[model samples]
Target: MTATATEPSRGLAARDDRVATRPLAARLLSRPEVGSLIAAIVIFLLFMAAAEPFRNVANVGTILYGASTIGIMAVPVALLMIGGEFDLSAGVAVTTSGLSASLLAWNFGLNVWVGILLALAVSVAIGAFNGWLLLKTGLPSFLVTLGTFFILQGVNLGVTRLLTGNVASADISDMDGFASAQNIFGSEVTLGPVTLKITVLYWVLLTVIAAYVLLRTRVGNWVFAVGGDAAAARAVGVPVRATKIGLFMAVGFCAWLSGMHLLFQFNTVQSGEGVGKEFIFIIAAVIGGCLLTGGYGSVVGASLGALIFGMTQLGINYAGWNPDWFRTFLGVMLLLATLVNMYVKRRADLR
Candidate 1:
């Protein structure tokens, strides 16, 4: 009787262990990150089925081309949001950096490397300012970054105009660093009849690196801690301030990279470049499963979100629809995704 009972107990424990493990696996698969990826795939399929041009190699390249810079920024932005902060000036800062690069190269006749370094330095400074204001004033990041956003916006346009006397832009192609920037951001590869911009490959590589760093590194652990609870993270010996500031700087650096691409790919730096993209980055981050309050997000999820944006941007055009309606479509999609994410998050928290 005792042996039979013990055998049954052991079987029950084994079953229970399996059951417990299953939920964890399921939970991992069902994370908000996974959801964003599903959304991207679903959107891509929907477009491919409805829009003939959507599946073409050319269109795919464009989708990725558009996604690259945004995707790059989205990773770190998601990190920042997960860390319970915001950087509203991020998009405008791209314009600032690009213009700075252009002016340094074209106007001042500086070496391209110097111009690039200057842009990066300025970006880091802007990021440091944002972090400082947030940490010192105890003001909400929304207000702080909003102020910075407007300031950068004005600076981007105002300074560019004052320097060039034109509303459009300055040409940086003749500059010394042009070759290197073009090599990195403007590289192209011939694939069949279509040319694939190699920056798309760069975006993919960056995404993989970002994902690995986010999911596999100790810094990633600290990122979660800071985002989950700043005070708690600090109490537990995490360098909350440094982590937050570093993330902001990363966002700035991404902005610089985007700026570099814009300067090379387009060969012009308009004062209006990257205007009104801050919220879009935030939207992508959120749609990728980032919490509005921070503490949870995924780089892959954010990249997928950027992919959705790119697909939608091109898909609507391929569907024989007015491209002007793209903003409306994006807004609606964002609203729905945010609602779904919020609902799912609340449900998970309850459980």
Candidate 2:
């Protein structure tokens, strides 16, 4: 009887040991986002300590507002990166979507809502075309997206000049449905002493949804498999083409949403706007732990990366530094984060 009782106790202790160690082991294996999270915290504290205005409630809202716009796109871009692809056109696509809406409504006398819907369709179709061409041509995504980026950029400029006789879209603030759209995309909410833009809510919603899809779904598993090894994933019956196409479309969808916010908030969009923002999106993703080689990253990490960007951008201004140095700071952060991510990934691989 004593021997049997001890046997059960031993088994129970073993089970408990596994239960305790499982999460730690999993965390060790999933260390890509760890570095970014730490970086974000460190940067936040650094800014707070050095810049008094950075700690103000209103300023906190400003930081988040800036973060939201970038974070909104970064989430989907991170997922696309995890799926082993790039969307270089993503930035200009925002302009395309906004221009589509603004020009469609202003020039054609269509309702603002109608223009918005048309823009959504056009953006999604553009993304689908990119994915389709990538698969059909067996071309590098960077090259394929670069082509689309230029095409869209040219269209944005050429068509805006042709239609508006100007480099910017006509103001749509007085159009039907403008007010409602603004309320959805550009409105602000006051919470106690802080006012927050609606974009923050959109950013949070997208992040949460993306995290769920990445962590808790079969499709998410397919994303990892495809990114890690597309051939192997295909051999195992993953829908590789469909997944890639879907990811591009996801980027397109995000671009459209962001464009809508831009249009509604300002009631106009520069035809040349969003030209270089794609690099920012990719940089944010890279800083968040998404590998250039694909197959490893985190949505939360990307969000944190965007948070770092917002804080740094505004923090510099609060510190009375030259705005031109922001790009220099981004380059430094990119290099440092890449090194840290590589080290973390190496350690994880060794284990």
Candidate 3:
């Protein structure tokens, strides 16, 4: 009896040891962000070695600033994509928000804060309308949001021209609350010899919050389930409509934040400023390991993808290459990322 008991204990210990000694490569490969992390490191090292200006601290700050601007929106876009929906209107919606804030304050003579609040409300409403239309009509989100994109685009250009007799809004830097708003959204913080935009902090904070919501909360489970199979999720009592609507609103909220940043940073917005940016957001999401089919993605991955974008945008300039080549680089990155993501997914499934 004693011998048998000792043998079982030994087996248990051996199993525990095997578990403890599992290969680190396996763990790393299991992460959705692992591919993005690798890509970021490779690109960083490449740019560091090849582009002299890329090594400068100030230039690094600029890269981070650019990344933050895109990352801030990318995170929410990733989440919405994971929830199995698209927002084609996201880019124009951002322009709409900024223009709303500027025109509301400048044209209506309201306080800047009021304009900000109203713009946020309008943005959220647009998002809600998109979500509602998708559910009510059982139509594809792509079509719904595409319609919204054009409508918002037309409104932006038409209203701006109608009001200002130009395609840009009047300057709002001198408005009441402009100083405070700028400090919150568009100000800079000095670290050592580098001045970084506040948007970096916002980007990081938003990523943390989104990651937590995705990984540690019930709603996160719902998000994944809904994205994976909306019908099954609904059958299991998940509030599919609410979850999707909430996701869209989250995107809207981020857009409002980004819009505020743009307005405060420049004090003006061209009606066409954000056109075609929706594709960039989608590409970033794809590069970050979010599947086009949804149900799998990480906010951290999306952020890293944005970082890669920022690096490439500046790195090429630092390398003294033609600016037009940027699109070619983006296409290549997108294709490679998609293939890697597919391979990773297949491996995970096999495991």
Candidate 4:
């Protein structure tokens, strides 16, 4: 009787894999951000040794500030990709937000806040439209957002010239709400040896919030589910549609924040300023351990990717090297990070 009972218990234990605890190394390897974290450290060491200015404490703030501009959008873009979508219009969308606020407030003699509010609405609506059209037509988001990208690019240029009689938005520094907007969006904060842009704070805040929602909430589960397999997620009663739409709207909201910062920080915005930035955001997401095929990524990883970008950008300039190779370095990192992510995933699965 004892032998029989023991055999049954042994069978159950063998079948129940959770009865065994995974090693700490295996657990860390399973995390999506591990590879990127490793890479970030290596890159930091490389720059720290190679460039003197890159080692300056104040330059840390500069690098963080640069990373923040990209991180602010990259975090949302990372989430959207985790939910299985793209937003090519994201680049021009920033310009659109700034231009919208600048022209609306200047031409109509309204408070800049009014323009800012309206710009937010318009940006969110654009994101909603993208999501709606993708769902209704059963089209890939790539094609949908690509179309949006072109439309917004043309509209940014055409509308800016038509309204402002120039290729840039009017300086709104003298307008009402400009001071508060500057304080909110473009302000700098100093902590001892470091001066940080407000966007950097927002970037960190967004990353923390996004990390919480992704790891700790039901909505986070839905995002992974939809990205892994939308039909399966829907079958499981997950609100796949709403999740994707909300993700896009998040991207839109962050874009508006970035746009406002541009408008206030420079006192004006170039109509063409954001034309190629979408690629940088996407690259940051990919490097941060987000896969090209979706369903796997981390917001923190994306931030690290942005940090790598900022470091390389400033590191090159500081080292007195040709900055032209910046994009080339990014392309290489993207390829390598993709390979590393795939290997890491396989290793995690094996573990």
Candidate achieving the largest TM-score: 4
lDDT of each: 0.82, 0.91, 0.91, 0.91
Q: After superposing candidate 3 on the true structure, give the runs of residues whose Cα lies further than 4 Å from its correct spot.
A: 1-22
lDDT of 3: 0.91
Summarize candidate 2's per-residue lDDT along 1-351 as a digit string, tens digits. 999889998888887744556558566545788878888989889988988898888777889999999999999999999999999999999999999999999999988999999999999999999999999999999999999999999999999999989999999999998898889878999998788999999999999999999999999998888899999999999999999999999999999999999998899999999988998898899899899888988888899899989999999899787989999999998999888888888876754
lDDT value for candidate 2?
A: 0.91
Q: Please list the residue runs of candidate 2 whose C-alpha ends up more than 4 Å from where it truly belongs after superposition.
A: 1-29
Tens-digit lDDT track of model 4 for 56-168: 99889999999999999999999999888999989889999999989999999999999999999988988998898899899999999999999999999999999888999
**Per-candidate total of colliding backbone pairs:** 3, 0, 0, 0
Report the C-alpha displacement of residue 213, candidate 2, in angstroms.
Answer: 0.2
Who is ahead in TM-score, 1 or 3?
Answer: 3
- TM-score of each model, in listed order: 0.91, 0.93, 0.94, 0.96
> Which digits, one per residue and each the tens of the lDDT, describe model 3 over residues 61-92?
89999999889889999999999999999999
Task: Show the lowest summed lDDT stretch of 10 residues, model 1.
Answer: 17-26
lDDT of prediction 4: 0.91
Ranking, TM-score, top scorer first: 4, 3, 2, 1
Determine which window of 10 residues in candidate 4 has minimal summed lDDT: 342-351
